[model samples]
Target: MNPLYISQKLFEHYEHIEEVKHYYGLLAIYALLLTAEEKQDPVLLGKCKTVLSRFPDHIQHPRYNFPSYRIGGIPKAYSLMKDYLPEAEEQVRYYAEEMLTASRDRKGIMSYPYAPEKELIWIDVAMAVTPYLLFAGLALGDEKYIDEAAKQTFLMYEEFLDQENGLLHQSKNWAGPGKYSEDHWGRGNGWGYLPLAELVQHLPQHSRHRTKAEKYFKDLSASLLPYQSERGLWRQEIPFEYAYEETSGSGLILYGMGVGMRTGLLDREKYFPAFKKGIEALNQICINADFSTERSCPGCLCPGDGEEKGTVKAYVTLMLPHRDEHHSFAPLMFALVEAYRNGIYDLPRDSH
Candidate 1:
């Protein structure tokens, strides 16, 4: 299917969706902004500017109520729209400072800002915080932000990565100090991997973090290759054979692989078949004619409460897939954008 057509339809659908002030909505907004910039479509870019204008500045934004991490996409969106939005620089700097000063564990890894008392560190934070910081740092000519962006991803990878399998656990401290969630969650790995991919793509060639980031990204990509289902998707619980095929995680993974191929960090010969199959599968199964999405896991963080919390069983059982979840939109858009970049576009049948 034509990636641009599908993306436009999805962007239009997102324009009318309500309650988009949170991370999920922000992610979709960021994806649309990225798409507009990539295609250089003035009309699409104008729509993105309108969408971004709806939010107030970073401090007064409703997303700040939860935690600083959730607002990563906000600054990321602003960074892209800096030319159009006069407040973009201020907003990006504000969030960069928030990330710099945010609470962290003894190891200096960023903790969940919502509950600093708990000192929780999760895979999700990689995606939530890293890219924006990298962008802001690059945009503002602040190396500290860039350092922190690389530092967070490297530290979290060292913490949560399972040496046995190369997959990362979803979170730490949810069960107890030094304890990690049991499952190799699909989306969790995506959260962890995507930032590394971003670093590989954006970090300067001679930057100190460049070599290590590329290695970590390549390592994770290799680890993930073995898990793709025959249908070109990943399961809800990645290593679990019985787990159902999931879209968001699959899309995120594919997006990373696409970046890898484009950047020469990953071997296209080794990865392109999977990437092709994945984008095609996502277009065929997840995105509908009207641009709604399906089979994306809902917002989940260590899933269950009480005894069931942070268990592998809980991850597979409690976090079932659903249709039209907001989380699905950005991931699908990311994969499609990457696919378009790689010259994989095919015209939709109806367009013919």
Candidate 2:
């Protein structure tokens, strides 16, 4: 089936689920709306906003029940909706501003008081939170959020990037010295790519960190492109051989690269091959008729320092495991829309 049909089907199902912060249905909603060929549907957009509005400005940290991870990506979600819903824009913007101020501190390594201490902390806190703050800055046009993202991005690289190899290790102090040491996780790299690529595109050309952001975008793309498996997906662990192809990392990389190509940060000729490979891999998942559209990889606490967990098990145990629950619709929606945007899936002509 075509991606739009898949999205509509998911939306119908989502209508029955209780709206919650972590449901992340908005990610899919935005993808579906953004990719439609026709004029913007006000009603559909309103429905998205209504669901998103249910998310409070901040959630109690799951581990600490404190205010950590407050920089959730609600601002970016609202930013996407605001152009069509100006009346509702204020409310969204208000929430965005509140988050920015609430999380800001001018000292070393600004962060939420509530960064989760879970075993899977790397994925949830590091990867998930980065995009939220980056988008919050872009949507609100605020310096503080942008600065926080930049700082965290740099800090993550500093702390987790292994000197021996260029890839990001999954968490801080993960493996024994030099034994499977500092091996990159596909999703962790994917997590790093999204914000830097998008934030650099959105931030002012002359922002103080513009050069650093550019280097980051270039380095991440270069390091990751070589790892694409012949089957057109990345392995869960970069150095692991013949691992299963994963959708969530593929989608994140696809979206990041497509955005990079769209905004001119990435070279089309150099990168489009990888983009095509990832898109084809993701589309293959759709053709497989798998209901669970996302495959979870190992989750991390600090980069290079924790055990890897899968998607399904994490959700069931409410604790991190090497491999468990599926992230579900995020990778599918993100990849489908990005595939359409990049002309990889031959979306109808009007979609362009």
lDDT of 1 by residue, 124-233 (tens): 88887788788888888899989999999999998999999999998999887777889899989999988898899888898999989999999999999999998889
Best by TM-score: 1
Which residue window of length 10 is worst by lDDT in model 1?
A: 63-72
Local error of candidate 2 at 237, Å? 0.5
What TM-score does candidate 2 get on C-alpha atoms? 0.72
**Highest-lDDT candidate:** 1
Model 2, global lDDT: 0.55
lDDT of each: 0.82, 0.55
TM-score of each: 0.93, 0.72
lDDT of predicted model 1: 0.82
Q: Can you list the residue pairs that collide in candidate 1?
A: none
TM-score of 1: 0.93
Clashes of each: 0, 31
